[model samples]
Target: GNATMGSGVDKHALERSSYEVLTGAADIRDAITKAEQAGYDLLPANADLTAAEVELLQMPQRERRLREALNSINGRYDYILIDCPPSLNMLTLNALVAAQSVIIPMQCEYYALEGLTALVSTIEDVRDNLNPFLKIEGLLRTMYDPRNRLAGDVTAQLSKHFGDKLYRTVIPRNIRLAEAPSHGQPALVYDKASRGAKAYLALAGEMLRREEMASAGA
Candidate 1:
């Protein structure tokens, strides 16, 4: 099993290297870049479902693996961030089934409100159809630009609608964030003084405060 997993990563590495290391291209810009290099276009790498993965549900083996993976991670960490494939497939469904909370990272933009409705609907669907315990942990404002009038309007709307569910910390757009992944590290490791790094640190502290309050309540 580990061999299979290792090979998969090696395949991706070769795919990524084919452009960056060998051909000396842009080193696969984003997640989409790497997916395109692997000979698949329009691949749902973000947690969106496809037809095939849903069909595989007929096999009990798939379900067993899902359950096992979920059970394995329980209580092993304080937080398990499941970056689901950008599709509503079996994997996404399994993640929804397992996770008790969902943290949506969103940018403050004019059309961002339109996107939140879809995500909120999906969470509602998951709660109604699969995971009853699942609730939105919060909506984190990412790549925030306070100078943008649209951003301010969107943030105000979010605050009005979700109140405390809108985190006070807003992550500003920063080059350091764009640079860190190239070195295979978080922005904190790459540039502690960067605005993005400081924002994330503030988010962490806010989350910790919530955790403390929850523990006290318990």
Candidate 2:
């Protein structure tokens, strides 16, 4: 959707075999078919398991559906990534309930901190009210400008506050990244040699490392 929103990410740039699980689709089957043609396996939403079902784990049918979906993917895929929309909507609540962890994507600008307090509060509230097992996946600093003093200062502050939760790989601002989505492609496929692509790759590796640590701990 962000790609379609014209943030420069091309929808077609995703890997040929990657799956698209559209929870927001008006017609689940149609969405799945389209994604299937594009080489993605779309997920269907059952009426009983909608995002509006906030107490999903407590609802017998909803819980069963969620467990089935999660269990079904146990060995089918190496990962089951949930792309959540930016909002405190019912959908976001469902995502929080479903995910064991959350990754916060942020820029290092001074203004970035403005909403972090509220976000952190929301996370804490969610942990208390809904999912106690949830944890922060990581804090990724994206679209960074190392030369900017404000960016440098904010990075230091965030690092101090988040400690090891901050990722080592910082995603720098790149024109190529801004341009990639227009062609419906990821920066990696659009410009593999570009700095943006390299940064995202590094980020992927970092994420994998963090996940491995989490798994080992579990």
Candidate 3:
């Protein structure tokens, strides 16, 4: 999941929170903050966002609230990534409804397959019921260790099952990537030369290349 706020945020510029925007108490624009170092605009969230899960349950068109909020700024961004909590809930449903596609990142662990199965089922349901355009963009393997036999086995299985949908770039386990969140910064800003940072850069390049190929095919 993406960090809610980067270290570059100017506290003085803050006005509204993601909770307020999701709950209809504030406009999405009011919750947006510029993270100059990260080179992206962020709608920062906090613990208060948890309350929105309950509050949204009582509201009409709860699953569509986020989609409605983001429509106003749809033309401003080329990509809008919504990082949902690691669970199936109203928040995740809202994200599914709002997104065009999903990038699923997972570790090469035994339990990860089970989780992926459940997540895929959820996405299929969402696609069928809520968003017809919703699809799985790709599966990203993260924290991969080449020396681990289990990891290699899982990766091979994933490749066999997912084929081209599994990204070629794998994010190796690195200390810098793990520490970046504590510093409220990305691995690229923390240590651009680190293996983790380089892997992520490669992933970005891969994604761009895929998009170009897709466009060409289209």
- Candidate 2 Cα lDDT to native: 0.64
By the lDDT metric, which is better: model 2 or model 3?
3
Span of 10 residues, lowest total lDDT, candidate 3: 5-14
Model number with the top TM-score = 3
Q: Rank the candidates by TM-score, best first.
A: 3, 2, 1
User: What range of 10 consecutive residues in model 2 has the weakest lDDT sum?
Assistant: 16-25
Best lDDT goes to which candidate? 3
Cα shift from native, residue 42, model 1 (Å): 26
Determine which window of 10 residues in candidate 1 has minimal summed lDDT.
Answer: 1-10
Model 1, which residues run further than 4 Å from truth?
1-67, 85-90
lDDT of 3 at 67: 97
Q: Against the hidden true structure, what lDDT does model 3 obtain? A: 0.88
1-218 in candidate 3: lDDT tens per residue? 24654445544345777788989999998778877788898888777778999999999999999999999898999888888888999999999999999999999999999999999999999999999999999999998999999988998898898899999999999999888877778678989999999999999999999999999999
Better of 1 and 2 by TM-score: 2
Number of the candidate with higher lDDT, 1 or 2: 2
How far out, in Å, is residue 129 in model 3? 0.4
